[model samples]
Target: MEASAAKAPSTLAKASRERRDIVSGEVMDEARLIRFVVGPEGQVVPDLARKLPGRGLWVAADRVAVETAAKKGLFARAAKAKVQASPGLADQVEMLLRRRLLSALGLARKAGDITSGFEKVSSAIQSGKAAWLIEARDGAADGRRKIMAMARKQQSAPRVFGLFTAEELGLALGGENVIHTAFLAGRAAERWAEDARRLEGFSPLLPEDWREEPIEAKREP
Candidate 1:
């Protein structure tokens, strides 16, 4: 399946942890699993934080796995109760993930850890302060190549994300035609990356080379 690159930030991937996939019956790290909590009203809800009440059920982060869990009554089986499942469960998860990711971006902006615009991003790249580089997928290839060239020159290479379109990125960062942006190294950027990775699994925003894997090892080179 075409998947978005959901690389985790350095703060959360120091060690690998495993969870059971309710659909595939395989054990994998949290990065590869999506948590679901049964709501008070018997509705199934996505709990990326894994802190929601009720027994948590895990499924592979892949959209197909989520759909299978909803379609094949896997959620009900895992919950061990008659639970309400959304036919658009994948869409809902994607929406929630996107919302959380954008909120994180806003937090990064408020913390003064974000830089947008081609010139600014290029500058950040040159300064080597960009720990996370984001480019709009719909943007011009020439511009992307230029920024990426800069990213490659950094001593600590930043994680690059191209999952969102120009309009989507603009809405998140509160600007028009926000084709390129970068997150300076910080806790906010880490949180933003974690959320984006979660959303990538449920959304059709991934590239053809995307793999079904965890975004862990935050401290690794």
Candidate 2:
């Protein structure tokens, strides 16, 4: 049974590699092929978790491949009957990507590679160990402005991100309240950046408008 089951995947992979069109059917490329079973109303869902209970349909992860599948009614054909493809499938994938990035950031914080609060973060910067800067989305603008200036002076100016809210940053850093945080480059930091880049197709950072004002020196409290 194990051999048979293995053969099934090999066969599917091989078949997907070859381009063939059935009568009154559309031709599909191997790269864009995802096989999934239809649920009620013939819903075609890509189970990224690979734990969904049903046959799965295969499709490319990009917008173009999804559109092609819809345009050619390929999903229904694959199901061997009529099936309904979910609306806004591409948006669903993007949401999953964002969740993945958040999880990675949380992991980095747990590994002690991240520090929070104005004082701790400033120390990290002064020590020349911080790789990325994290600011709360709803943090005080004046405070953020002050920090951005200090970051700019560093040899490797840290990229500031404001996507996560203050509450979220606080939770990650194990603090009651946190407005600023810094990540040190290492395994954890690298993983966080990689996930962020994959989800947003770039590093998450504070908007240019937010960084317009230069940070100024202030008396230490």
Candidate 3:
């Protein structure tokens, strides 16, 4: 146990070393930066998984930073070679992040780390077994309000994500009209939460018009 504890600080110290953003020249955690690589055609491609083989050019994950990088030829400058960044590069990155987030949600569902429907979600939240509360963007306002009300009463309310439409959630989770879903507390939930948080950099996790009292949930350290 002593040796295991000793290794953690070293691991964290390594992670503390930040990557430089090609666009802003500012350093930040890799998690907050989007990596890009020059493809065979010399086109800039987002390396969302950071496993693409090649020298990586990083930019802050914000849309404005991505747009600025693409507009200013920052990728080409960083690569020290001719590269093409499509005008829609920011949109492409957003799509990739959304796809990855949904794929993580699908995996969570197959692993039985999620529950759907109003009653099951409500129970999970009330029982303190939920790590995330996913509401369809098109779900009824009344039902969403009631769910949030229950969450507010909990000692530790689950984080909420209401960005996807009912059809999108349904397709990802292999269900029809999956308006309300609860991610059960576990490893699978933790992985999905990380993906969701990453996507939040590109898109709002809640609907733009969602107006209700926020539930204060404990965030990951």
Kindly report which residue stretches of model 3 are placed more than 4 angstroms away from their true locations once superposed: 1-17, 216-221
Instruction: Give residue 220's error in model 3 in angstroms.
Output: 7.1
Candidate 1 local lDDT, 63-100, one digit each (tens): 89999999999999998999988989988888777777
> Tens digit of lDDT per residue, candidate 2, span 104-175?
667777778888888888888878888778888888888887877788888767666677777776665567
* Residue range 3-104, candidate 3, lDDT tens digits: 999999998887765689998899887877888999999999999899999998998888889999899988899999999999999889989988887888
Model 3: lDDT equals 0.86
What Cα-based lDDT does every candidate model obtain? 0.77, 0.64, 0.86
Task: Give Cα distance to truth, residue 185, candidate 1, Å.
Answer: 1.7
**Better by TM-score, candidate 3 or 2:** 3
- Which regions of candidate 2 are displaced past 4 Å? 1-85, 202-221
**Candidate with the greatest lDDT versus the true structure:** 3
Candidate 3 backbone clash number: 0
TM-score of 2: 0.59
For model 3 the TM-score comes to 0.88
lDDT of 2: 0.64
Tell me how far candidate 2 lies from the true structure as C-alpha RMSD in angstroms: 10.0
